[model samples]
Target: MKRYLQYGFTTFADHYGSSEILYGQFRKGLLASAMPTTPRPIGATKWCVFRSPPTPYSRKYVEEAVRERMSRTLSDGIDILQFHWQDYDDPRYMDVIQHLLDIKRDGKLRIDELGLVNFDSRRVDEICRTFGSGALVTNQVQFSLVDTRPLYGMASVCAKHQIKLVTYGTLCGGFLADKWLNKPQPDPYFDSLTPSQRKYLDVILGAWGGWELFQTLLSVLRAIGDRHNGLSISNVAVRWVLDHQFVAAVIVGARLGVAEHKDDNAHVFGLRLSQQDRVDVASVLADRTDKI
Candidate 1:
């Protein structure tokens, strides 16, 4: 089995844009949002994430942030800079690209190290045509056994252009483990009240055809885990994502110093889910994505 430190290069998202609200959440301070603009002097791959466009601010506000952040890249000689692009149709999309290119052209950002968040196959070709070859490195999205939307088509688009996938939501907010097996449904208000927490359970129960079927799928995963020498349900689920065609990395969130399942997460590096494993697990899932 691969060691946890072997996958230690996964990107960490510090508090949103270095805000005090986020910084206060941690006892030990994390890397700043502008850290992406600074490369590791010893050749380590550096990553940083921003929560959203600094809003309630004007275009000048946005431009100043970009310029200020990008300037650090020039001073520090960084290569790749990462950010999210939620809406491709947004007019600001063009401006964002132009700023990155300007940074690259001026030797602040490396041309080969641009990445965007939340894009899937439908947008891959458009991204390529707009950014050109080797301009982008990753198309980060949600991909897991419980969420295989990428497998339906996104994999092919990414594979064609050599774009790597960075996936998240692999553990489904701790629901993909033994703790939930045969458990009573969580209260929508008192148990799973957070919007995301509720929505994912809905996706799982709905996809598996109902809460009853989801339990069955969990049982199947448990059996598979036992057969594989006490492999974890979390491992099986994340390994399934890695087994997909174009995934490069999976982001498993860490709550600092609370190293609970970091060991199981490392198992993903070496485990391979068998064909029967895939069929058994995917069988109960609904392809209800057509509504969108």
Candidate 2:
């Protein structure tokens, strides 16, 4: 499932690389032609496909990407293919499902080889019923120590249906790490980063109770890190999400050639956040509202 979904990103990247996809064309035009065009989302910006500067990814591109990925997976001796959609109603979605079923009947694709992503908890049963039992594999969503709303309903639904979860934004873009512990409030326009990056960082600070409160939260995590054999704050953040049941994996972003942090990221599985560490984190995070 992850492989198919991850491949989708590269598919979009390839399209963008060639300026064939709608958003890719739009972005290329915006950059090269210097025309004042309306911004479109290239893909899922939040958790799935984050397009810098934002652009619309049309249905045609998604369908093409899925087809190519599915074909590649079948050729690789992998029977399962996890299909993901930001919305449930795209015509290509039905077409893809029907195509897969047709192929499965003809011994091309297997029935147990399909899955979905981004559906709400309320729709899980419907998904399972429509797709068949064990067909819908995952409901990837934004779940983290800072955001517990998924636990209220989605987690239970997943548990009931025996579906797995692939969580993103667990570290909230490295904001949970010690880098922001006592750092001053970020200048919205001072940094050269993307608008989306600045926006999420601000939200993380605000939700963690601003800079002062964030310092306190960092101290607690640091203490926990010491007890866990000197695990870093990032290790604790990732572990906190992974420690929860139903989380099959936590998607952590990797900046290529940044060898300094790779060793630290690897330590997440080595140390566990103690019960007291969780309590302290909750205490700091209590009553703080989300900024997303």
Candidate 3:
């Protein structure tokens, strides 16, 4: 793993509200530990869009932000810059994106590609139209078996623009795993769920047709998993998302040394769902109308 780190394939996303200095130090320490004899990969780091609000509209501010980002992670080799924004109505995001493009054009930064995070379908189409199809490469969004809203509009725009969808939440905050399957509905007060659990639980209850429907979905996934060499529910869930044509990749959250699914996750690559499996899963999801 350390040797792999030296090859520069390790990618890290900037956390909101965190200082760049701290992030740089952490990245540097990891890279320094890697063996120098290893062959270097094409790029090392992927900087996400900075969310500082004071000057979102200012080109100068945007440039400075990019400069700061490059200064911090350039040593690690940044491959792509992914942007995140809250309000789609704000025209300033376009300005910021244009400025980043201009910076890339100027050869001031070594960024290889640019993309968006959590931008809606409409906004993604607008950005692609304004900037041209190749300007952006992907739109990262919360996509999963339960939240298939992206299938409706985002998929078409992405297909048209040739932008792939990098999906997160495919496991629904670990709720889709076998540990929760057939288990009694958790009491929010008595059960100690992680922050992700609380967040996605709300989505499950409010938008995903509540506990009963979720159980049905889980049962369907379990049956599919059992047929495919007893793959875990999470593996089946992720495999289902990967089966989609629009999905470029799935971002599975890790807790480092605390808990790891390295082996179970590896099963996803080997498992293949049959057409009957797809039909069974789709049959369960077809009844739901809520969009996440």
Q: What would the TM-scores of all predictions be?
A: 0.73, 0.68, 0.86
TM-score of 1: 0.73
TM-score of 3: 0.86
> Which lDDT tens digits does candidate 2 get at residues 1-292?
1122223322122122222334333444444654344332222111123232133445454445445543432222223344555555443445455555555456543333444456677666666566665655666677776666677787787777788776767777667777777777677778655454575666656664466666677788888888888788888988888887888777675443452365677677567666788888778767465522
Local lDDT at 180 for model 3 = 91
Greater-TM-score candidate between 1 and 2: 1
lDDT of each: 0.61, 0.58, 0.77
Order of candidate numbers by lDDT, starting with the best: 3, 1, 2
Model 2 scores a TM of 0.68
Q: Once superposed on the true structure, which residue ranges of model 3 sit more than 4 Å away at CA?
A: 1-11, 14-56, 74-77, 289-291
Q: Can you write out model 3's per-residue Cα lDDT over 92-197, one digit (the tens) per residue?
A: 7888889879877887665678888889988999999999999999888889998898989998998999999888888988999999988888877779998888
- Model 3: lDDT to the true structure: 0.77
**Regions more than 4 Å wrong, model 1:** 1-10, 14-80, 109-112, 192-195, 286-292
Candidate 1 lDDT for residue 122: 68
**Ten residues in sequence with the least summed lDDT for candidate 1:** 40-49
